[model samples]
Target: MITVRPSGQRGYADHGWLRAKHSFSFADYYDPAEMGWGALRVINEDRVAPGTGFGRHGHRDMEIVTYILSGALEHQDSLGNGGVIRRGEVQRMTAGKGILHSEFNPSADEEVHLLQIWIEPAVHGTPASYEQQALPVDAMRGRWRLVASPDGADGSATIGQDARLSATVLSPGEALGYALAAGRLGYVHVVRGHLALNGIALAAGDGAKIGEETELHFAADDEAEILLFDLPPTH
Candidate 1:
């Protein structure tokens, strides 16, 4: 079965300095029916104005991943990890027992666009950690590029869950396929441009929850970028 979440139907917030779209319940956006999909808890598409960003915040027991789409974001955490994550870079932070972090747009004139994802960790009270890696543009063009996984396979940032995240960029008329094992859950998020998933059309910011299906196909109607998540069933 596949259920589509249209982009216009998602929760939206405009904080003057920040504009955000939430795929699941987060902050002031609450939806009992949209609390989450399996262990995938949150997907926030955010745009921060120049010189503005999220201040230091605390999180625990969640695997937080950040994908920068444009501009640059400066990150500083209590673990003493600091860096600027730019386009083509992925950041993974494990807020196990507890962690403090801050992310801000460093560009003086360019807004930073990004996606922040949260997945429930499999274990609690583990040590907090952070990792960041640059994904090759050529690797993702017309193919699935592993970006996050439990084992850090293919140089993906490690996460504390039985989930795998892959990213792809497709040209018009290009197609891709994926196979989900029995009992697994799949999710597809269209980052930019138009695409069709299993014959269903999706636009930017749209998402799809898939289950009980063995095969999946993606065909681009325009130049597009997408993220696919393979998740374990919720207990």
Candidate 2:
């Protein structure tokens, strides 16, 4: 089945300095029916105001991934890792054992648009680690580029789970396909522009939860960017 989650239907919160939309139940936004998809626990599309962002926070046993869609976000952690993640860059933090971190918009005049995602680790309570990788525009043009996986496949950032995430930037009329194993599930999240997945139209911020399916085929209606996840079943 392919279940579509419209962008406008997500849980929204505006905190002056931070505007966030939660794809799953998070913080004050709780939906019993929208808990999460498979091992993916959270996907928050956030827009941080100029020179403002999240304060120091602690997390544990979660694989946190951040993708900067626009502007930049400065990250500092108790592990002594600090950097600025700009557009097209993906940062992964294994919050095992425990980790403290802060994310801030460094630009004085520009807001930072980004997606912060959390995935449950297959193994927990291990040492915390961090990694970041940049996806060049050319690599995703008209094709799916693997960005995260359990083993860092294709130079993708390694996660602590049996999940694979792929992203794409397609030109108008371009197509991409992904085949699923018999029992695997999938998820598609539209980041920008417009596209049609298996005849279902999706615009920016839309998502589709797939299960009991075999393959996914998408064609761009215009210039579009999307992220796809091959996930192990929670049941």
Candidate 3:
């Protein structure tokens, strides 16, 4: 079964400095029926204004991952980790027991576009940790690049969950495929441009939930970027 999630239907929050779209409930946007998909808890698409961003906030027992699409995000956390996450970079933080962090756009004039994602930890109260990696365009061009996983395989940043995140960049007419095992579920998020997933059309910001499927296919109609989530059955 394939369920399409149009971008327009997602919850929205425009704080002037932070315009965010919630794929799954986060902050003040809540929907009982739209709680989450399996272990994937939150997917917040954010556009942070230049010179402003999120202040110190706390999180616990969560696998938090941040991806920068454009511009850059400066991060500081309770673990004393601080750095700038540039375009094509991925950052992961394991808030085992608890942790405080802040995200800010370092640019004084250019807005930063990014995604903030959260996954339920496979285990609780381990220890707080952080990791970051910069992916070159070659790594994602025309293929699924594993960016996050349970063990940080292939240099992917480790998460606290039994899930894998693969990212890819596609050009017009480019195609990609993945085998969807019978028991594991799938989620596809188009970051930008138009695409056809198994003949179903999807636009930027669109998402699809895959269940009981045998294969996953993607074709780009224009230059596009996407993230595919191989999710576990626990939410």
Collision count for each candidate, in order: 0, 0, 1
Q: How far is candidate 1 from the true structure (C-alpha RMSD, Å)?
A: 0.7
Measured by TM-score, the strongest candidate is 1
> What digit string (tens of lDDT, one per residue) describes model 1 on residues 52-144?
999999999999999999999999999999999998889999999999999999989999999999999999999999999988767999999
* Candidate 1 pairs with clashing backbones: none
- For all candidates in order, the CA lDDT equals 0.95, 0.92, 0.91
For residue 169, give model 3's deviation from the true position in Å. Answer: 0.9
State in Å the error of residue 52, model 1.
Answer: 1.0
Worst 10 residues of 3 by lDDT: 226-235
lDDT of 2 by residue, 48-121 (tens): 99999889999999999998889999999999999999987889999999999999999999999999989999
Cα shift from native, residue 184, model 2 (Å): 0.6
| lDDT score of residue 31 within candidate 2 | 92
lDDT of 1: 0.95
Q: Give the Cα-based TM-score of candidate 2 against the true structure.
A: 0.98
Which of candidates 2 and 3 reaches a greater lDDT?
2
In order of TM-score, best first, we have 1, 2, 3
Off by over 4 Å in 3: none
Which model, 1 or 2, shows the larger lDDT? 1
Query: Residue 63 of candidate 3: its Cα lDDT?
Result: 93
Better of 1 and 2 by TM-score: 1
Clashing pairs in 2: none
